[model samples]
Target: MGATRSHRIPRRAAHPALAAAIAAAALALTTACDPVGGLNSAAVAVTTDQVATAALQHQHVDIKWLTCTAHLDNGPRATPSAGSATKDVADVTCDGETKDGRPITVRGTVTQEVEGRCVKGDLTAKVADRTVFRASVLGDCTAPAPTTTRVTPAPGGHPTVTVTVTVTQSFQGK
Candidate 1:
């Protein structure tokens, strides 16, 4: 009998170099499709005022204070030489009104994680240690009454108040 002959095609593995090239090409294509600057984009730095505004908004409760007053233990410190500087810790009290002009008073503590204008995790806000403080848009945090003795003391090496205006809208500044 004649010798039987069998023919079969051998399978070959993909080249490592070819696989790597394909992967690199795919990555490049994905990155090129990005319109806005991705990782390479530079973020604009915000001011301390901006961050403070955000922290205030974090309270979630609105206090119409545009005409009221505020005292911060470590809020915004005014310097006789230059401008004011934001503090790291603060005990703040804002006496103002609500949107409807009801009187309201809000107190809280704000802390700046870092000494910068950034306020992501660096900014923290906590309401005053109280159950519920009366707030309104038609009146001040407290009803107007006669004063016994006037007292105004500095926060003791803390920022006092830079803005007396109550903030309703979010901080929309750069």
Candidate 2:
């Protein structure tokens, strides 16, 4: 019989690290796909949609549109249903920081639409004569059509590639 020596696995195995990295990457991809839940390279959940949701809710619509046409600062805005009333676009603002310590702010209304009380199938979320929300604005107010927008955060020190979200929204009573 030959003498046998005890063997033990290494405390830090490359396999485990690799697995964790892969899992993190996979999660990042998933969150990145959504308007919110962005990883921001450092697992930072920061974005326009997230900010808007925090500031407002039950008033979100997948509002998507193009802005600053010449500069192409495309934005997002959701379509509201007919006879639906939008909660007044809150003249609210929020402050937050990215994963990299970069401060960001969302200066807009929380986009959304809801249907319930339809007095002659007409509703509006106008402020000071500004058509921020309206029932049947799209001509069809039977179904709720979510919207989207694109927003890119300011620079984060290094040359980091920015992901522009096409829209930001939050809905209530639906």
Candidate 3:
């Protein structure tokens, strides 16, 4: 009988540029999809703007600039509760000056909603050591119900099926 020989195929290495590009794309996707951090920043900005607006309305003399800051009370690791995903909270402070050079200040705490997008909280604005405005703001984070889709092959043609599910989240506020 004749001797039998085996031959093996060689594997090729990935190109360095291609590999780098893939890594960069992955990193970008990871950062962009960070729900918690993104939500926190957005919530803070919105809350600050709302507070400033309320203060302006109460003062009715804002002719200068206003700045606000928020300090997270629960930090990043805080988890939402089982019944309600209300966990993230921040203490906010704002300062500005009116056209007449009067000092304006706002203070409050903001709470993140279950959906992780909207917020609800109460804020108080003071002008020159006098309380001028106080109110509570609510953000609507209602999401639609989940939807499912199924695809089945024709009878006796092939025993194959495909299923898909979709979920969505949204935020609304004044």
Candidate 4:
């Protein structure tokens, strides 16, 4: 009997270089499609300067104030009243996006009072005329009121003893 003959096609091994090229292309495509990669593009909108306002309020107190005056602690000496306070603070700013792709900036400040003796060494501490405090997207502008202590020698007539106290800080978002 004649010898039986068998025939089969040989399979070629995958090319290492081809595999590397394909992997690199896939990586490049993935990185290019990332959403954050085009952050500088025109499609990314930004907000502009915006203004906002807020009010400051007091909640509690420990010492008796002369009156609620703008001075840190100035009031009528004859009557015991809560003193008014003007806090040194800056405005706040924020960036936001609207549903329709509009950019917005929000800025605001709060009016509040501080507690303490109004007269100290004849130098009364009033709220600075300039804005010294500021708030940002990640910052706040609330500052405790600054106070000074008044020292008066114990005298035979009406004598005043002054103690330093911080005023309450309050805020209203606007």
Best by lDDT: 3
CA-lDDT, candidates in order: 0.28, 0.26, 0.44, 0.21
Q: On residues 35-153, what C-alpha lDDT tens digit does candidate 3 reach at each position?
A: 44423432353335433544455456453545555555655453455444445566767676665678877778766422322345777777788888675653334643112222332
Q: Candidate 4, which ten residues in sequence have the lowest lDDT sum?
A: 41-50
**Candidate 3, residue 37: how far the Cα is off, in Å:** 9.1
lDDT over C-alpha atoms for residue 52 of model 1: 36
TM-scores of all candidate predictions against the true structure: 0.24, 0.19, 0.46, 0.17
Q: Which regions of candidate 1 are displaced past 4 Å?
A: 1-64, 67-88, 113-174
Error of 4 at 118 (Å): 28
Q: Which digits, one per residue and each the tens of the lDDT, describe model 1 over residues 1-174?
A: 001011111123224454334423322322222213211000111112323323344444343331212122333556757764544433333343434455433344333212122312122223433323222111121433212222333445221222211112233458
Flag the better candidate by lDDT, 1 or 4. 1
Q: Cα lDDT for residue 43, model 3?
A: 31
- 1-174, model 2: which lDDT tens digit per residue? 001111111222225454334433433432322223111221111222232322222343222221110011113433565554333222223233333333333333222212210111232332223344443222223644223233344444322232222222233335
Q: Evaluate model 1: give its lDDT.
A: 0.28
**Runs with alpha carbons beyond 4 Å of true place in candidate 2:** 1-45, 53-57, 60-62, 65-105, 108-157, 165-174
After superposition on all CA atoms, what RMSD does each candidate show versus the true structure?
Answer: 29.8, 23.7, 23.0, 34.4
Candidate 2: give its CA RMSD in angstroms. 23.7
Least well predicted 10-residue stretch by lDDT in candidate 3: 1-10
Instruction: Provide the clashing-pair count of each candidate structure.
Output: 18, 30, 0, 10
